[model samples]
Target chain A: MLELQGIAVSPGVAIGKVLILDREGYRITRSQIDSADRHNELDRLRTAIAEASKRLEQHRRDSTEKIGVDIGAIFSAHQQLLLDTTLHREWERLISDSCYSAEFAVSTVLSRYAHAFRNMGSDVMAERAGDIRDVERTLLEALGGAPLQVSGGLGQSILLSHDLTPAETAGLDRSKIIGFCTEAGGPGGHTAIVARGMELPAVVGLGSFLHRIARETTVILDGFSGRVVLQPDEAALKDYRQRMEVRAGRVKQLTEIRDLPAVTQDGTRVTLLANIEFPGEIAASLQRGAEGIGLYRTEFLYLGADTEPSEEEQTTAYREVLSQVDGLSVIMRTLDLGADKVGKFTLLEPESNPSLGLRSIRLSLRQPRMLRTQLRAMVRAACGGKLKIMFPMISTLHELRTARMLLRQVIDELAEEGHQPPQKIQVGMMVEVPAAVLMLERFVREVDFISIGTNDLIQYTMAADRSNEYVADLYAGHDPAVLRLLQTSVDVAQAAGVEISVCGEMSSNPITSLLLVGLGVRILSASPASLPQMKQALRQVRLEDCTQIAKRVFDFDTAREVDAYLKTRFAELLPEMALGV
Target chain B: MGIHMRPADLLSRTAGRFECQVLIENNGQSIDCKSIMSILTLGARQGTQLNLRVTGPDAQQALDALCELFEQGFDESDSEVATEQTS
Candidate 1:
């Protein structure tokens, strides 16, 4: 029996025969072409090139029809690479002049270009090496070489790969793919994001040991714990089977309440919303019964771009998202760039401590043009559907007022330009910093709503970076100090008659959601996948019970004590909930 | 075909076309136009003149299309919004 530990990107337990997708770095043998067969060898090269081009064009069309035009452009580039006269001539020359075989010639020429791309000294350029390699493999397959494609059939085994690109992940056959593990990729990567959206169990960053695991090996993947056990003993297999059954039961229970309202037994209706970064996620969120989009992270538009997106570009994107969401309100967070999430377009000096450095609202305030451009697009997109603009990392009232002022200015400017201003839109602030929580009373009166960004709030309150494993233990939302702040903000917002939502990781946790509801937080925003589970857990507990639980939780001194108390309490109250939490 | 452009900008506009190799040589730097990474390494900017060389079955057609693209200044009409969602 062998075990591998990795970062769990998605939650679930999957057991299947391993199907290793060893596509990268496939070996190609070099050989001399016989003089008698040189003409046939050249013909083989031409046929291979044409076949690869046809396949790429078909993939491009399929991608356009299934996903969108932008992704189809990737395959279009591949097609262009196939038709590149320079590359074609290089291969032809190797066959005619160097007397190299077609497959060897193609491999050698493509790898030379791939190496050139990799040695470009730019990260963006280096990434294109993967694309070159992808095209090379496709050409090799067309040349009667060993097939590099992953076969998809019903009930196929789990996929293990070095890494999966966005295109590869998108093309995944949902019916065949049981789950996937990769040696590289983070939780925020496109592969993990798609896995979460598809509700597929995935574990990434497993390191190189994963590559050594043979095909068809029986393995148990615990995505929740980010562990994969290979060739387990009978006792271990039995235990895993029981755990899987329990999880399946829990999932079945959650699915039963998928369409049900997130209300307690006492009829307190708490709104459950989804936090989405891309417009493609709206379908999944709505399918999972999200009331509305609570947080539409807009920073993604600016990140990974060579230049700043024009106002029209931004408007087109926002409008597409708004139009798709129907009439559901979308709280669009304006350009939350800085600290750990800096974009290429926005230039900021390197900081020793970026978490506390100039970022978010501060960065926006410093570069008002960037904020104005986004605000203009947002205001324009408001015509498509219900829109709510939010400013992130508001540490002080001054920053909030300044952001509000800039928003109003953009509205007025648009009006002057003969554009009709949005009739109704709510402006809000994210209560992420400690100062914002302390000044909750003042903040509640200023904005239409308040979103408690528990991720950053807990990190800042505990003086710990959540991403750093060394400080991860210190960064707990259930800590008395953090909980008190959350409670105070909820209390203040309730009193002020302003809508407040907990749009953070904590809102997804059953125990924390119970505590949030007990503390009078009426709205919770989390990933769409967690919505059903959150609703299921929320429906079982009465508001009175939650209130008592919260009261007892508050009495605890340390986060550990509070966590233990809640676990025991929930175990007694709801046994199924205790198992998952 | 005198306008200078970055590799990504050029690729975005023309990479969807037929599979034909294009080579651009300028100031002693020779690079593959089909490969965005190779083009980017050259870092050609405004006013940098490049000699185009095309070779393949569709070399003439590829050359004409590329020359026309360069002549038109790679100005993709704003009417068609290519929405590539980043996440």
Candidate 2:
């Protein structure tokens, strides 16, 4: 049995076969086939090649009809390349002689051809490598390999990979993927946030373990202990199974307190809400006793689809979530694309530094029609109800004002079209950029509410990318500057009488949730899975003690010092909560 | 800037018309002209010299058509002016 230890980013225990993924998140199955199956594998290769050729033929015709001969000819070339006689012979040779699996042989042959083309000392030849990859992916799909997206057709397995981008993590099929064990990612990475949001067991930063395990190897991932045991002995399996049951019992205990009020011991009530991606998750959020949906990230509607969702589709989805909440306010944040989530939806040129480039509000402002369609949907979905709209990654007041103006124009246009406009809808902006916080008073006056998205705020403030492990230590939520900014945002919002909340990953942590509560943040929005624990933590503490804890952390010089102080105080004040945390 | 011809298109349009075995030898590599992929791998840029070898019943006809096509630069228009912009 092989044992590896890494940082545990999510809680729970899972034992299942692992699906190995390459850096690009494509499933890599390279096991050797039995010698007897060589003929069948060869037949499989032939069948797949035929299937891919047919698909390319269809694409060629479609493109020729829709686009022109130039585009259609590209697909025709792909088809010819797929049917390349020499390539077919090479694949058959690999399968029959080397007894390699059809999948392995196909990837090997295509990769070899692509490599050869890349080194041919001509720019045009190197460009043909991309065509080879397209053919390779097409052939693989025809061979019944998992689709390129990693979100579909993936059976039950623990996903092991080098790392997962935020977009890939967000698109993970929770029903099929049991957990995540990445070779390189920090606890504060966006993958951790998504894993925690989905309540999947994950352990990251297991450096160089992808080379040790084969695909579909039964492994035990103990998220609580941050250990992954490969091919575990029966005793280890039994122990892990028992631990899983115990963790489940603990979750059951937490769920028992779900219906209870999220009120501090001193009679201070805080609104606890859920951050959800899909409208379907609203029921689960409500089951976990979320008072409302604090953050409804609308990017999922655009991410997995070929085209941007129509305004009517967005309206229907938004209306579904709002209707399910039953009068509770649903704060739907506009498309937060780019910066690890850009896909086919945005038409902006690829920037050198995407996080600082045209993303979120910047992209929305540049493409007003994109923003208008989304705003029009939100306006239509409002239907004079408690639907609050918020813009994400608002770095400047001008962007916010422009977005608000576009929203107003959308509302007026809808009204002119004889659509009844909503009576009232609260418009807000996320305080993610440091510039926004520096001008917090100016912002609060122009909006009805503001939520602190600490993920981006901490990333932007420290100049440390949350998704980058090398800078993970620098992306500290406990940094004096970050804490000060949080306090300032809260103070500004409170003085201006604008409803303030924190819907970042930091708020999902038990101690951080208390700190935000102590810093005068009355509403905390986290993943639905974390609501019960946050509720339990809030219920045990008095508002007076929380404020004291929040105040003392500000005096620390470094994040380590602040973290140590918070840990010691949390343990001393709430011993039971410390264990679960 | 030099003359440009879409090698894949050049091969796709003519390679299959002959029953002869067609080969284009460039830079000490002999590539099958019938395979668009092989023809592309030649990386035959502008001002590059290539040797054509054909052997079959229609070898002479194949050789004549191919040589004429190469001379005409596959009938490509304004290729030198187009100058395949390299990034």
Candidate 3:
């Protein structure tokens, strides 16, 4: 039995045979191919790539909306490269000129392209190699002329590999692919997105997983926590079965609550919105009945792109988002880039501490062009939509004033340029830095609304790095300090009579959400996937109950104590709520 | 020398390389360089360490980075956990 641990990109549990997508990488058999076989083999390779392309398109059609069109388009690109006459011609010439076999020439050309693609000095470019490698593999498979099946019969085992490409993933049969584990990928990667969309349990980024896990072994896949148990004991199997049934039931229940309004038993109605980083997630949020988009992270536009998007490019993206929400309010935060968000070439110098350095509003003020371009795009897109501009990492009143000044300046610029100004859209601040919380009253006066960015707020407030797993257990959202700030911020927002919402990782966390509600945050926004569950939990507890429980939770000394106390109180308070409660 | 790690173990051996007893993010196989914010995103606070032995093409460099982040010499003050929740 082989056991390995890795990040849990998607959540689920399954027991299925493995499907390894091992690229017999590119190989040269040290044999000279006759001139006759070279053309024939090249033709076969072309055919295989073409066939793979068609299958990818079909997979796109069959795939539910969760798996993005990008995945399909990636396959489509691989198809083009495989069938590219230039690449094929190069291979042909290399074979004849170098006196090498078809396999040798193909391998040489493929490796050269792969290496060049990987050395592009960007993560996005490096990732493109994954798709290119798959194309090379497909061509190789065609030379064998045996129908390669990634997934087949029930007893037939996994197609385990170092990694699975978009093409390889599209080719796998749903029924036979009980679960897939990879030695590479992350929660944010395309594979996890595909797995979530396909309702498949996947444990990815487990290095050398194929070398460890045997073929055809009845392995238990725990996608919930990204665990693969091989040849499990009876007790383990039973536990997994029960867990599976519960998950299926939970999903069915959550789906049922899709269109249901998030109302409390006591008749208090609250808006549950989605905090989205991309335009693609908008549909999923609407499907889950999110009242609006509370947080449309604009940072993504600046990140991973070849260059800072032009004002036109930013406008196009912003307009697409505003148009899609369909009358729902989209509270868009301006570009919150810093040392972490800058493109590789743009990084001037590495800082000893980036989070503490000039970032967010600070960085934006430093690089006014990037910020202005985004603001112009946002303001332009705000026409005929309930859009608001939010500033992230606002610490002092001067920062807020400067941001507001820029907004007014932009509005005047639009008026001068003969452009009809968009809505006098609401302005907001992300209460992340502790100074922002301390000057809550001042900010309340300056901005239209508030959304507590708890992730940064917690890290900066606790003076602990949230990314350092070593100290992960130390950074507490429920700490007296965090609660003290939250309590004051929420109270200040209420006193000021501006609407307050929370859109952060903690907002999605059930315990934190409860405390937030108790602290007087009426609008709870998080990932749409967590909305139904949040709604169900919200329905079980009253504002008064939540407030009281939150008070108790904060008073606890350690996170362990707080977690334990909350769980016990939650069960006692909301018995028969959801099995989870 | 290659340090073993689960690709998904965000706060495992390599994850501990950041901030030692303090806190930091696990970038690729270890702490994210260029920006502490990237490490902050990892949300690692549980006191996880540089388990992989320091030796490789960039071993000394990696160790130097670790030492700098952890504030080498571990003065009780440097390694001190803020016992009280500061508001």
**Most accurate candidate by DockQ:** 2
**Model 3 misplaced regions, further than 4 Å:** A2-10, A14-226, A230-242, A339-345, A575-581, B1-87
Ranking by TM-score: 2, 1, 3
Q: Which regions of candidate 2 fall more than 4 Å away from where they truly are?
A: A5-10, A21-130, A138-155, A161-173, A183-194, A203-208, A224-226, B1-45, B48-87
Q: Which window of ten consecutive residues has the lowest lDDT sum in model 3 chain A?
A: A22-31
Measured against the true chain A, the candidates' chain A TM-scores are 0.71, 0.84, 0.68
lDDT of 1 by residue, A507-533 (tens): 877888888888888899988888988
Per-candidate DockQ versus the true complex?
Answer: 0.06, 0.25, 0.01
In angstroms, what RMSD does candidate 1 have relative to the true structure?
13.3
Candidate 3 TM-score restricted to chain A: 0.68
Docking class of 3: incorrect
Residue A311 lDDT in model 2? 89
Model 1 chain A: which ten-residue window has the lowest total lDDT?
Answer: A22-31
Candidate 1 displacement at residue A408 in angstroms: 1.0
Q: How well is each residue in A1-581 modelled by candidate 2, as lDDT tens digits?
A: 89999888888788887777654245765435678888888988888989988999999899999999888878877887888777888888877887767776777677777888777656766777788888888888898777545446556888888778766777777788898898888876656876877788999988877656643468899887799998799999998888778768878998899889999999999999999887878888998999999999888788767788998899898889888998898999998888677767567675779889888888888888888999999999999569999999998889989999999899899999999879788999999999999999998889999999998999989999765666778988999989999999988899999999999988888899999999999899999988988988899999998999898997889999999999999898889878766
Model 1 has a DockQ score of 0.06
> Tens digits of per-residue lDDT for model 2 on B1-87?
112225465664576688878777776788887877677665565556667777788877777776666557653522221111111
* Model 1 lDDT at residue A85: 65
Better of 1 and 3 by lDDT: 1
